[model samples]
Target: MSTTFPLLTATAVLPALGAVATAAVPAARREAAKWLALLVSLGTLVLAAVVLIRFDPGGARYQLTESHAWIADFGVRYELGADGIGVAMIALTALLVPFVIAAGWNDADADIEDSDAAKQRRWRPTQGFFALILMVEAMVLISFAATDVFLFYIFFEAMLIPMYFLIGGFGDRAHSGGEEDGAKQRSYAAVKFLLYNLAGGLVMLAAVIGLYVVTADQLGEGTFSLQQITEARAAGELTMGTNIERLLFLGFFLAFAIKAPLWPLHTWLPNAMGESTAPVAVLITAVVDKVGTFAMLRFCLGLFPEASAWATPVVITLALVSIIYGALLAVGQRDIKRLIAYASISHFGFIVLGVFAMTSQGQTGATLYMVFHGLSTAVLMLVAGFLISRRGSRLIADYGGVQKVAPVLAGTFLVGGLATLSLPGLAPFISEFLVLVGTFSRYPVAGIVATAGIVLAALYVLLLYQRTMTGPVEKPEIAGMPDLRARELAVVAPLIALLILLGVFPKPLTEIVNPAVEHTLSDVQKTDPEPEVEAAK
Candidate 1:
């Protein structure tokens, strides 16, 4: 039976409405804004959960689709739907926002003892912060759910706005040398992020127009529907010269790669994460970045299979470079935030590598990596935020004997760091293992070379821990640091629980993810390579 509903549309829009409601309250009742945002986010989570519960994982196509033509001439439509990948991303986005709200409850407000000048200039109104977060959530959900290529582009670009303000307006300016200088740095990071993504968006826009033109020329009309374009290509009704298809593929791939913040193009990520508040960092790294990999699987490969295959060697090479380069950079970082940022770059390399490897297990591992990385990174960044909030510094040398002062906090940090390194029996390990296994199935040399990154991962993580969390208390300022507060525990406990839970029983998530991976591989018309057996001697 075919079921039709506007559930996907509702899930995407509710957060925006919540943002509006949060902003409507008077400034006098500003604290209420956090509660309101949380309420809205929780409601949004419920809606996303409903979509997941109702989703037919057994089905091979998008579900709960709602489409209506908005521009008949251009063939654009306001369409929304989700396959398994989309659903998982949406659910992760929904799950993270409420916790981000909890974790960053007072993050926008200036410290109580700050100089009047600093306070006056740097204080962000709390209502606006939460509102921006909710707005970003809405856009992310829409981007993941959007079936029309143009609509996806709109949401994709629109998301940059809230994220920009979140980074620029609410960043940790006090930690920088001076208030003015810190604000300037934040503004610079924001602009750089915007320009990089905007340049990519413009390239993608050109490719989108070219695709539309080709479709129009072939069928006597233009269309921006992904399903139609894919179907047309499958039926041999849409054809472009080999060079042109590859060019278009590169255009879209560049945007996604930049957003993936793949190596060489990844310079902006450390700056952004270094300056932004914890929750904003979480949003940028954990939730928003997934859009890049998701789009690669959904659009790049689905729409341009041969181009993707042709580009695989180059893409996998970049992914490998990202893994090794990001790990080495992380090992040398002085700032804690930048180290985590670099670690994320390394982790994203794993995700991208699994993606381009084009094996079912690799693809599944990549998808699972997306979810697990989000959970783990959120914990690491949030815990680092908690430490920074107490120590008033982001440098690695600023603290020592932290475990003695705050054992719970130290333990939490260790667990997060271990998870990042893909510790055995943790959520990330299973996915990372799968990604490498799948990669080895097709390209043994790349997989074997990439394994060295795990050693680098341990080096960076353990070094960070040993330097900051161990040793005698060298500074009097560190001795009295508080353990995790009730609220802090509340914020981090679920993430920790999920990490452990998923590590033990990843079957539920993989069950939902595998079918989607199989479907994507079918679209690309590729399968895992057969293994060679040694002859009996």
Candidate 2:
């Protein structure tokens, strides 16, 4: 199952190289830079698809692995591999980048050089914007494929740099409080995000050290290979002290929870998502943040089984709280983008809840949630972005009777909203159903409370639709809002198609994910509970 061809490395490195090339384009050729970025992302997608195709569901747990000496002294190696979970994430990341580039095509063009001050900036602002995005894609791909703990952490923390600049430098120009105040807000959000994650990464660094120390003592050499540690534990060759393991788990989990922004630690999300441009917002929720949840399944459960079980009760409680809190806050939001931000927090709750639920169905649902939520969120947010760009406002109160003026836009928006609420025929419904079924089997009380989130989701999504799309055109600004153009439609239509295609036939993803879910549950030494009632044969 391991390969010498280094396909995973190629998949990750291509975008990085493209990022440099795109950024190097002359300041005036914004169009050329965009095309270069798009081409590079498309190439990455092809490589990711190849990896998915070459993978065998019934093959080795980690396939297409490449290992070379990295740091002999510390036992770190340049290692990469993919399981079903990793491949799915890689596919999602690669698939979304092209659309992100297209959707944000003109986002950086405004104010590119209105002042002598603006003209002095080194690289073209437009090129830098797209380059930053591609750079993030490269880092995320490596995070997904990385088999070395140190390697994962390195890229994990590094991604924050580009994100910080993206939020602060290229923020939306529509300033509610004037341009000066808008600049301040972006600065605040960017700082808050960086400080929170950096704090968590520091804590995680301590835990990473703790984990390495444990492995070193047990194996007679320090190592950061996830595969090596996991195999050793499976073979009864490596054992961690309870106290040490719990501390390590807490450290790692804290970092991911902050990144996941699991409530209490989640305050930074609304600002970050609200302040960034729409494509970056999608990049934040749909792409970058999934790393937190994915890391939980890969590292937390993989490295510390007993500690994970010990922590499950509290984790699931936090998830339930996030679901309700995010949904409630979303219901009260007046801003279009912020509403989606709150809703994403709610969706991340479902994904996290499914992960901690531990049953095979739960894990599979969680992984699928990650994928479908990305698709649903992309469709919703990108369409919302287009709407905002036309009107130059993010406030919901500013819109009315959009359906009459721009029927196609309203229609697509409606579909996106329906998917967010997990309507039965939508892809999210499948993941949501599985999570509830899996949680109910193991913990009925938690399952019952979680359903309240569904009710609230319906409320927010419907109210959003009713207030914005269905009313009479009450403002002069609403009269000439054109419907979706070719570029915007190109960005959205594929995602909607995917939502329908996967909603009806999730067999493709399920077949790929189910086996990986089994492996994850095995790591945690858990199994699904038997049903109390069964259908008659």
Candidate 3:
């Protein structure tokens, strides 16, 4: 998979350059800027396709690698590479950005200057909104492809800047709180998101520095290169004391867990998604937040195998809590957006459970879950956003019998809900099933408790659909509500198609995912457990 050309760099840089060009567009030419950003994202998607095509799953582990000296004195390098897992995530990110852009076409109406809230917001420049999105995309793409731990950490934390502005400045216009209260809430959510992630980043910084020192002592040079460090450890040239390994592992894991937004570290997500516009919310969950879990596979496990194993039991416990607790909370949620947000927490719990399950099926399922969750969450959240925009209330009580008027919207939302609950004949079902199967093979009690989450998921998703989409059109605002418009349809349709297509024939994704899972298991020096029962042979 080695290459002389820098495809990875070009793939990342295109949107970054696009972001700059987009920001420089005439202040009044918002449409032009939007078009520019969309085209840039599409171009990025083309490059991602090439990356995927060039990738040989059966070839070397890391493909399309580009390495160059960056900070030789400190042993840092401008290294970028993609394994099957990284490439799959990169493809997911690329595939989704255009849809996010298309869905948020009018999310930040810079011309709505008549209202005091708009003026109070200083007619927040439309150019900045789109620019920030592209900027975030560039950072995330780099994060996925980055092989140097320092390089990854740099872009990992940098993505938050644009995301913070996207959430705080261009929040959802359909707030039940009135404009002023909504603005306050947006600011609060944005700040809380920043503080939470930044706290985790700071701890990670300490761990990063500790890693450099450890490498310096062991290898005679301070290095943050994942490949170099791993090779050294594999060669018996470097080893960490048990306590040191655990501390370093905690630093990395805490940051990822927060990014994963696992329970206890998950409070910021509800507020952030509740206050932000839906597209940005999707970016948070579907794209930006993935860096955390991806890092767990790449850095936490790849670099700290012993520590990863040592902490698996506790991590699995937290994941189980996240699964049940998030589903239970989703069942009780009155706000439509918060319900989706809480549901994501539960989905992430399943994902983390797979990661720590330490079985080949478990890790592979976790990886697939990330991609499927991105597609399904986008469909549900964007459609929900459309529904809320029509009613101007995020409250579930404000909606009723939507299917009667906007059947298309309701139908798409139902599919999304079913996917979220991992219903059979959907993409998420396979991933979730693999996770449970993997976990059961190792820890039956954990797997049994996790099934409770599936039941809870059914309750929340069905109840949400029942209350909002399939009722008597009692609420006056819903009677005149229209179905998914052409633009919104364009966004949700393909994602739904992907869900069904992958559901029935997951070979394409599984083919890519399985090899990556094998590499990851090798990193941890683990294998799938043997089945307890034998076929009647």
Judging by lDDT against the true structure, name the best candidate: 2
TM-score of 3: 0.98
Can you tell me which runs of candidate 2 are displaced by over 4 Å? Answer: 114-123, 534-537
lDDT of 1 by residue, 1-537 (tens): 135668888897899999988878676566788899999999999999998988888975888888898887788999877888898999999999999999999887663334656445433378789999999999999999898999999999999998898888889854748788888989999999999999999999999999888889997889989888888888988887889889999999999998988988999999999999888899999999999989999999988899999999999999999999999999999999999999999999999999999999999999999999999999999999999999888999998899998999999999999999999888999989999999999999999989989999999999999999999988887998899999999999999999999999998888888888998998889998887986789
User: Can you give the TM-score per candidate against the true fold?
Assistant: 0.97, 0.98, 0.98
lDDT of 3 by residue, 227-293 (tens): 9888898899999999999999999999999998999999999999999989999999999888888
Q: Please say which candidate is ahead in TM-score: 2 or 3.
A: 2
Query: Once model 1 is optimally superposed onto the true structure by TM-score, how far is the C-alpha of residue 78 displaced, in angstroms?
Result: 1.1
RMSD after CA superposition, every candidate: 2.3, 1.3, 1.9
Off by over 4 Å in 3: 114-124
Q: Could you tell me the lDDT of residue 290 within candidate 2?
A: 96
Q: Arrange candidates by TM-score, highest first: which order? A: 2, 3, 1
Pairwise lDDT winner, candidates 1 and 3:
3
